[model samples]
Target: MDIAEINLQSRYVFRERISLMVLLCASSGRGFQVIPTSGMTLRSRSEHHLSNGDKYKDNVNALLLVATLVATVAFAAGFTVPGGFSSSPPNLGMAILANELDFCYFLLCNTLAMQCSVVAIVALIWAQLGDPELIHRAFHLALPSLFVALISMSAAFLFGVVATRRSHNNFLFNVVFNTVTAIFFHVMVLLLGPYVIPQLPGVPFL
Candidate 1:
């Protein structure tokens, strides 16, 4: 190579070395160096993971509380059934409206609610073991179980009320039935409408 070309190449190499030295010096302090890009990325990932863990814990705690409450109420309802127990010797200790269709529905719904809540409780307990993958799977199971428990509990309440009411209180029964049905519909819409609305062609907001 010519001297001029070699001189130019040397200048370029010197400039690159200077730039690299400056960068290195800027990154190094008295006793420590700034984190490299890979280190920063790992730190950010750790932070994100911790944040997700906290969020999962919060969700589990809230759902656990709700499941516990539902289980408690359903257990109590099983013992003190609608219309109370029969006092007569022939049918003592039996639910008074046990033969009624509405009472049968109430029992079925209550049992479903209790079972679902118990499942949710168990799933949420598994979610607390501090493993991200396990926590995610547990939440998947717990959320649907909790939702079903809530729905079943509401249905049980409605059926129990109906079974205990007298025919003379027809107006009151209608009011109660309408109120509960409306509330159920409202909740279902709030929970499921987002998923359902987009699937319908030309449908507006729910």
Candidate 2:
């Protein structure tokens, strides 16, 4: 063949190979488009297994109920002190142990317990009614509030026991009860306090 004809044939063969390559790449692209990507598949599976916030609602409600009961008892204890109320005019039927330090401590703890318990209950209720984000925030707040309420309630009970025993003139009994109460308080604070309180955001070290 002549040089011109040979050159024209080579050019035609090169064009055909280029066209075939382009067609193959286009077909491969379309094939890949037909299949779902890994990310899409993962997202779809995740949606199918999405968590429900109400899964723990029953547990939280039970805790709140118990806390409310403690609050009620604490509130009632404020009115019914260890010793009977005085009938004097100036005091106007106030508790006889009102001026005593242990009695005062009991009153302070009872008030704190009642307030914290109420706050915890409110937070839990709001968590049940609010959005997911709010629920998370409320739960964090409620846990700490409930912890404080429990500790304060326990302290109030201990103080009340001490005050009552002292008022009855039982010196040995008072010492024994106070020692046991102190041990119990220390155990509770050491074991549970650190675990519960530090989990809360912005909570200072105790």
Candidate 3:
């Protein structure tokens, strides 16, 4: 193998070993919550102030929209290119490139979007919490998002099981199906904000 391949294999091995150690440590249950120097506990419990400011909410909503769109595009496009490579023999290198890019792009974009959505939701809650006027209405609006997230997670699990069972080598289908399904669900969830959000009873829409 070339130097690059050797380096990659070694990195993979190291990561695998680290993963094993983490699993073992977690299973040990020694209650070792090593805090970071950056006041990790403070960060974990930090409270955000949600403003009813239209600009703030709009910005967050816009961010969610953009993130979801980008993620959807990346996931869909990545899946097709990578999978297309396998149909042509003697294109192993191209296939590998496509497959790797598909996995990485989908993973990165999807994760960023997911994280941003959570942050936005937390802001929404911070702003909307404690008004008896809004409990059920807020919940109803958020329920669709929750339901979609659950469905997406279920799809991911099902896909993993089915793909593993079939031993499918079609990276494009798997990646595309997984990424597109997830992004579509998330996007739908974000879009539900206006319809259900205004329904919040006690909480005034910022």
What digit string (tens of lDDT, one per residue) describes model 3 on residues 1-102?
Answer: 122222322123434433433433344455443211111011111122222222234433543454354445435543443333554667743644434433
Number of clashes found in candidate 1: 0
Error of 1 at 166 (Å): 0.8
Tens digit of per-residue lDDT, candidate 1, span 1-206: 12222232212243453343333334343333222111111112233445545545666688799999999999998998989988888998888887899999999999999999999999889878766666656655666677778878988998888787778468876987788799876987577333112122222221
Best by lDDT: 1
Poorest lDDT segment (10 consecutive residues) of candidate 2? 34-43
Error of 3 at 159 (Å): 2.2
What's the lDDT for residue 144 in model 3?
Answer: 39
lDDT of 2 by residue, 1-206 (tens): 12222232212243443343343334444322211111111111122233444544665677679778978988888888787798988887888888889899999999999999999888888877635555556666677788788899998888887776645677887688768878988898776554344322222232
Worst 10 residues of 3 by lDDT: 37-46
* Models sorted by lDDT, best on top: 1, 2, 3
Candidate 1: pairs in clash: none
Global fold similarity of model 2 (TM-score): 0.65
Model 3 residue pairs with clashes: 52-206, 133-201, 133-202, 134-202
Poorest lDDT segment (10 consecutive residues) of candidate 1: 35-44
What does the lDDT come to for candidate 2?
A: 0.63
